[model samples]
Target: MKKMFNYYSDKYLASWIIKFLDLIVVFVGFVLASLLRFNFEVAGMSLSKLLEQSLITCAVYLVIFSLSKTSDLVMRHTSFTDIHGIFKAVVFSLAILIGMDVFLYEGMDYTGVFLIPKSILIIQALLVMLGISGYRLAAKSIYATFLNSSSALKSNVLIVGADVSSLMTKSTLLNSSKHSIRVIGHVDNHPKLQGKKLDGSPVFQLDNVINSSFLKEKGIDEIIISDATLGPAQKRAVIDSALQYNIKVREVPPHEKWVNGELTENQIKPVRIEDLLGRSEIKLDSINIQNELQGKTVLVTGGAGSIGSEIVRQALFFKPKKVIALDQGETPCYELGNTLKKLPEDIAAKCEIVIADITHFRRMQQIFSKYKPDLVFHAAAYKHVPLMENNASEAVETNVFGTKNIADLALRYKVQKFVMVSTDKAINPTNVMGASKRVAEIYVQALNSQQNSTHYIVTRFGNVLGSNGSVIPLFQKQIEKGGPITITHKDITRYFMTISEACNLVLEAGSIGNGGEIFVFDMGESVKILDLAKKMIQLSGLQEGKDIDIEFVGLRPGEKLYEELLAVEENTLSTHHPKIMRAQIQPVVSDEVKVLMDRLHEKVLHGDDEGVVGGLKQLVPEYISKNSVYSRLDKKSSQAYA
Candidate 1:
């Protein structure tokens, strides 16, 4: 019997079986309705006539059910919509029967006889509606019970929101046979919501104090946060308390991300370190961005890169005339092309992917001349500090010369706005990559000062969380390998932002910049790399120093224990946006800087690494190299200047 029940309970088979059962239920409802109307006496009614009427009613109900497609719904996942569909089918079927009875019985009454009474028809409609809806509800309950019986272990989870997202998440978890989670209650921050109930789950107020003991006493195995409005600090506090109580923490994505208007078990994920950054959500002036970008030809250099590609994606949101995604990497550029192709036809039509190196000045100039882009986003550069320390020539070629090439082209082409993507490393540089970028910044800022038509803007921020070659991916790889995660220094720290946040600021800066301005993003607080690694290990459900060891490999060449966002000589002025600030620094003499840049460019073209490094130090007096072979050059430049 159990085996047969299980076989019929399968999702596909259950739907068909329910349809067949519904037909039988309709016939039975008519028979019972007739018996009730006649008080179980058949002396006045013809048995043949009653059976014929019952068969006709069943046929009508079947036709209505088929039209409504109520039987197509998965019986185990029956929802209010399904029940509503059943109700509509029953009501329509009853209405059609009433029409037939009013006409047919009028003619039969002339002969002083009736086939089926109107009272029985009404009673049958009520009974049929109840039977169909009740069967589905029963099926859903049985399926849930069977699943629970099959699983010996189930986690008691508390959801952290009382809103629609939390309800959907709870329903999805409960209905999914794949997950063994029982929602124990909901916790909300609203005091007025205390003692309320959502779908029979009690709502409890979470005071500012997170008592781990109290949560443990409730047998809460996990806490799922489905509220998007919950701030990062509050989320972090909850996670900390849950961890102290040995309860797992998960989060449901915002309602906007729900699939097919319903949440799913697969969508819930473990809380990430990025969620604890506690930075206010960035709000972009999309109208302003759209006004600037709409119907304009925009060129994005290094569009295959993490930050650059994200900028491309966001730019599409503004409905630009064309986006020229230029990159030198053949594979990444091709992959980007494929990704763009997958976008909606309208959006894909606006994207043009090109493969060309920014260092190739002639090729880039040809592109600028062909497209005549109205706005230029220069994101192409060599950014690895240690790698650039060894390959200073490449760094200078890409970071310094590449930027100059794009900037000069933008000016020559009369591009309206030019936004350069820079790094926090460019501030108080200690490495070739940082110093090269600083040189690029100086060149662009100085160039912008000379330009009247082209408005040059520089947006600088720290590390992006999941960019290619970022520390997060490296740690993930190490964790997957079940071994030591390497950190440069025990005290090393850096600011991190998501790729989306960085790109949004880039677009915002592009729109708001009138002229030469180095826009700095508020990267919240710097995070210790050691702590980040440990948190990642714990989030992976591994004990730090036991399951996964963290090894301090000492600082690499040109690496620093901490990163600075602003130089010693620079200060910041507020912008309209809270997260973005403009750096106020001594203005550069464009002509003098141009002469120096010309010299630096010539040396870089000739592969004179020492000359390039020396020229950089001369241009930026604060370019002090640390743990690098170029330290001697810095000492020499300081002595020479002194």
Candidate 2:
């Protein structure tokens, strides 16, 4: 019973108080009008006439206020909305008050020679409206204070880079009663702001804050770098500092979000794993994008996989006529289909899912004929290095033969474009996977050179972080199991990127490629595998050496110590997208190449693993089998062949 009374008293009684303030406004307005008509004198010329005019003004003000519903405007949060409501209130009040004055003077008060003019009524109404609006404005501030105090929430923030966005971030934090965050201080790269004040918080230099022994002693919680203009390298350095300090760091969304006016507190996210890779963001050309994919029927071969699914998401955003997604995996396909179903109705309708293998040439041909797709993204391939070493024939059959089947069908269907997803392993191959990939790259490039239509382009890059069989998720699972995190080798390093970033580069590649061009993404610096494991453990808030033990096993079969983005012979030519480059590679082909490839495919079909390896080595002379028991070509040939 007591709790119910408190609820009613707090809400219902407070509402009545606000309504009384509105009534006081109406009464005060008429009194001020009467005093103004009497030239500021206390005594009025005719008390009865003044009373009658004041009552009529009060009645008019009440009717307008009720119609405008001005008393119910207390629930607005932002000042902009309040200002809008105030404008409406003033306009409605003046309209009704002036209408009442004209009615009384022209229709009923003609006998009086000393009646009030309508112009004085306008001035008095304006004064009373300003007074009431001012009171409501003050009440809004008081209400915000009450709400903030009741919540007892504050976020502990340490801002980096004292830029304009930093100040805005501070203001947003202070204005919110929703989150429990507080700005403890600011950390800037520039030393000039060391002792400066921002929103009543002390500013400290970043070097002093992180390296100083006393900085962390002050209980500085989270750090935010609000400067969007910082270059990739600078941003990387700041993020590294945050990781070192074990404090979460935040960054703004990309320019696309900013230009769309999507600036908000929630849009700001913690610096992700990709930011540490230190790669520059890709810039896409809108005109080329629209010309290539908008409203066009397209097909993605490995559609349920990481890269393929991202392509489907991005393609649907462009409002394609239809997007055909083909994959062999059941679970991933079902998951992707489910996610697509949850998208907006228009986007959901654009996606079509098909479960099929690319190795079956007949099935791929039928799909092409059925959909008549304008473009195709070929991403299905066997990529695990050590696993491929054990099963070399399957790797060769899928990576080499699968690519040939897709290319042939694209030509048969006269598809406008065919993009083959290639890898850095193809460059100066030393493993079975790399050898097969190199062979596939040669086949596509050679096909593009000879073919008149169906422009064939290749996009090649190194490892992505969370792809199938990636080491990151493996390490995370091992850590969660409360034991050792395994690493193949302490010295091994590989170039890494996020799946989203890689797919965007692929899209940009497709937009810029003409024909027979190999597109290479600018992968950032290679990360040491051992260091990556330690950081992951630290991010989990566990001591690396004590709580979680890291085990360094010897290098696996066919694993390279360092992955390269380009072959020793290939050079890069800059394209319109800074992060994408056109590889200056020579396409190797001969008149008898088709017969040789056909014979090789037959060997793969007949389970002749030895013959397939021999033919693959002969086709791509750069293929050097390393750390494997498989047969290598007797003669060492320096010339790179098709």
Q: Which candidate number would show the highest lDDT if scored against the true structure?
A: 1
| Per-prediction tally of clashes | 0, 6
**Model 2 TM:** 0.73
Consecutive 10-residue window with the lowest summed lDDT within model 1:
107-116
Quickly count the clashes in candidate 1.
0
User: What TM-score goes with each of the models?
Assistant: 0.90, 0.73
- Give the per-residue lDDT digits (tens) of candidate 1, residues 192-294: 8888899899998766336546687788888889888888778888887877766788899877787755677889999987776646678899999999999
Best by TM-score: 1
- How do the residues 56-106 of candidate 2 rate in per-residue lDDT, one tens digit apiece? 666666676666666664432334444566567667766766665667677
**How close to the true structure is residue 386 of candidate 1, measured as C-alpha lDDT?**
89
